[model samples]
Target: MEQNTAAVIRLESVHKTYHLGEVQVHALRGVTLQIRSGEFVAIMGASGSGKSTLMNILGCLDRPTKGHYWLDDADISHMSKNELARIRNRKLGFVFQQFNLLSRTSALENVELPTIYAGIPPAERHKRAREALERVGLGDRAEHHPSQLSGGQQQRVAIARALVNHPQIVLADEPTGNLDSRTSVEIMDILQRLNEEEGLTVVIVTHEPDIARYAMRAIEFRDGKIRRDQEIEERQIAREVLPTLPSLEDADAEEAEEESKVAPGESPAKAPA
Candidate 1:
């Protein structure tokens, strides 16, 4: 298949097979898709539906067993491991379900690690890392370690790490899996801002319909093949939806008030006299 000159990602007849002893597992079968630059895409599938495998191939972390993959007009299916690593560092950013931060390291340090691998100068790395942290609304938390921050803050730090490199595409796998409902929407808001304001291509894998609704396009995979691919007619704006959702802090405060109604060790039967 001929690659599109404008597409950031173009996969043609892509197939991935994993051999386990005598059995061969076919993960993706003939997946041909093109994602234009600055598009927000959500990949949906159940477990073992090949979405993760497709993501790995798209991110240049792994090569397809059979087929052609072009990233920005460059055919990378035949690239060596070293070449792929360089491409990944130069053009790709990844976010995983797990925060993937070092517990003892400060948030700023965690976000700065990728720049070191990218060969950024020490002074410039600090500048970019701090800018990314501030972009994610974590400037005040830069000195705190992972353990000192909440789950959402940790994920924000992870996002800052992803953005510090300023890659063309950001591939996020289940980015909101560990966050609460409100926090998940908040994370989506951040992703939406990055896509809209910075023109970054954003591709995220998520199983939740509510989460997928936030994207402009949705692609569903089933039985190792793309089952459906279509643009959303009326996409829900995360910023608009956020205001309608209940606030997590308010909910926590209400819960605390309810708990305060009763003393910590006081029984219902023993009233203060």
Candidate 2:
């Protein structure tokens, strides 16, 4: 990807604290970071590490206790809820752990949600929804309800809904948490293909290590601060898993052999962490 250096999300000395009856709960402790446009990023942290808090603030669902946050052109830290709602509906797409589709609604209708909020007319909304669903390879299931779809299909619908708004950045929290191993691969393949083809900026949060490998860079968090950010790269693809592993230069042959022998069941990749 070209290095444009334009930041889509920027945080400066941000802190978020909650007071539970005078006992201060520091969720985020002065975090300063920037996520550039068209970059695939994964944020990983354990419970109470502030990943969720940061995700909420980044999504404009909550205000920071302190700090300056800029999402695109707006200073999001102090925006009114209504304004944040508008921005979220128009500019940000979200995919959550649970497929949050309305059980009775058709895939097309679910995808049409943000358009409805945007006040787009029914005709245009349907067209856009159809196109979005088709992009996720679910065009034929446009009329199916959530209950009628498989786990992967339902998640695809959720992804379709996220894309229906045509937002450049997608915030996904444990998007594949509920899927099994094979199914998780299918979802990552979709996300990876989307990143390569459309250059969509996707930020995902996950605890799984393998899922993190799918991302270009993974940002690890601890105690509300970024601990380490590493680039997990894709290995060179051979047509098939080599029967007899070739020697790796500049790497321990024993360790390389161990890594090479890893089963496909091992990694579904995390946000890259």
Candidate 3:
């Protein structure tokens, strides 16, 4: 492991296996993956395909049975639970299908949780959380609770919380799974913006091909190994920014109506025109 390198995640011959009764279940069999700083990747797999296991390993939440794993020059495969906890708190951010906002907490406070864990001053934490919310176009909803926000808005707040730490990489698991099609597209647009405008490295695990299409590269996992890895074609050339949920709604409604005119079972979310 070299110092000052740009690669944030590197795994070599990683293997993860679990023992169930007298049987052994290999979740990740000899996996190797590397993510450079600023890369946007999507991991695609069916249920029980080891994608989640790999994500856990990358996120430092679980250890591999064998092989080397490095995060920014630190070999973490042998780190103690406390060391892994510290590293996860500092270097990683997470967004889930469920927004996972705290109950009885305002959006601003939800976004402040990570910094609070680091023992940052309250004033500083609030300022950074506010900026993070603004980055995701949720500045006006800071005072609202998660229950008060729409699905997309809640996800935005969750995203803001993830970025509040200025983490080097964001680990997203089924980030859009709970949203409607239009709303899912909206969330993907926000993530793409964060990657392009802020140079945030993002790695998402998803089962939907449409959602995975938003990522720059897609890795397919099958039978505990990578089946395919390649850059995505038809990369979105330009993404439109909407300042509010109403604007997105209006745009989506108009687009859906237009698509309705083009025979049944067709979707206009694929392209605006």
Candidate 4:
């Protein structure tokens, strides 16, 4: 692989071991990889393949048992828990499979949570949170609670929360796991725009082959090691793909028409989250 001067993440022969009641499990074994700045990459693997362990380490949520892990050329493999927490707040953003937004809180409030933890002033926090929500095309929905928004909209709020901190890399784990196909594409479009227009580095962990097609590169893991690393020759553009998908407005109209057919006092069924 060619060396990049702007390598954002580098892991050298990294390993992670877990000891569960005298049963030892090696989650990652001698995995060496480099992810450059502003690149979108997908990490694909089946269960027990160590991709989740790798993601935990990359997100600074866990440490490698052996070997070096560097973030922006700074060795972090052995950093103290407090130090790692600080670095995570300063340099990384995370989007989980669950939207993870506070259900009762407004979207803007959820996005502002990170900045509050980072010690930003109240005025600055509100400003940044609103800007982040606007960036994700959810400015009008900022006052709405998670329960009021659709699945894709809630995920967009989560993405906005991640961006409010102005981090270097966005680490997303199965971000589209909860949504329908069309909604998943909408989420990917947001991520793609962030990577292309704003030069944000994105690394997503997914099992869906079609979802991985949107990334610039793919890394496959098996038996706790990297089995394949390929630069994608033809990446799908999520923006272009969205236009070809079914419109949410049409779906809403169809649902309302169905609801009208129901007997009085019968509530409409909610869509799957």
Per-candidate TM equals 0.90, 0.84, 0.86, 0.91
lDDT, candidate 4, residue 44? 97
Off by over 4 Å in 2: 1-5, 235-273
- List the pairs of residues colliding in candidate 3: none
Query: Per-model C-alpha lDDT, please?
Result: 0.86, 0.79, 0.84, 0.87
Q: Candidate 1 vs candidate 3: which has greater lDDT?
A: 1
**Per-residue lDDT for 223 in model 2?**
97
Q: What is the lDDT of residue 74 in candidate 2?
A: 73
Sort by TM-score, best first. 4, 1, 3, 2
Candidate 2's TM-score reads 0.84
Q: Give residue 64's lDDT in candidate 4 (0 to 100).
A: 98
- Residue 52's lDDT in candidate 3: 95
lDDT for each residue of candidate 2 in 1-273, tens digit (9 for 90 to 100)? 333248888899999999999799999999988888877888998988999999999888999989999888579988898999998998899888877888678989999999999999999999999999999899999998776666667778889898888887889888888765445566776777677689888898989877777788889999999998877777221222222334232244333224323521222222221
Q: Identify the superior model by lDDT, candidate 2 or candidate 4.
A: 4
| Best model number under TM-score | 4
Q: Write the per-residue lDDT of candidate 4 for residues 1-273, one digit (tens) a residue.
A: 456578999999999999998999999999999999999999999989999999999999999999999999889988999889888887898998877888679999999999988999999999999999999999998898776676677789999999999999999999888666777788899999999998999999999989999999999999999999998888999889888866764558445435523521221233443
lDDT of 1 at 214: 90
Error of 2 at 143 (Å): 1.0
Question: Which residue pairs collide in model 4, if any?
Answer: none
Model 3 global lDDT (CA atoms, 0 to 1): 0.84
Residues 142-261, candidate 3: write the lDDT tens digits: 998765666667788899999998988899999888766667778888889888888889999999998888899999999899999999996652254234333556656655545433
Candidate 1 to native Cα RMSD, angstroms: 6.9
Off by over 4 Å in 1: 1-3, 250-273
lDDT of 1 by residue, 95-202 (tens): 888778876889999999889989999999999999999999999988987766666677788999999999999999999886667778889999999999999999
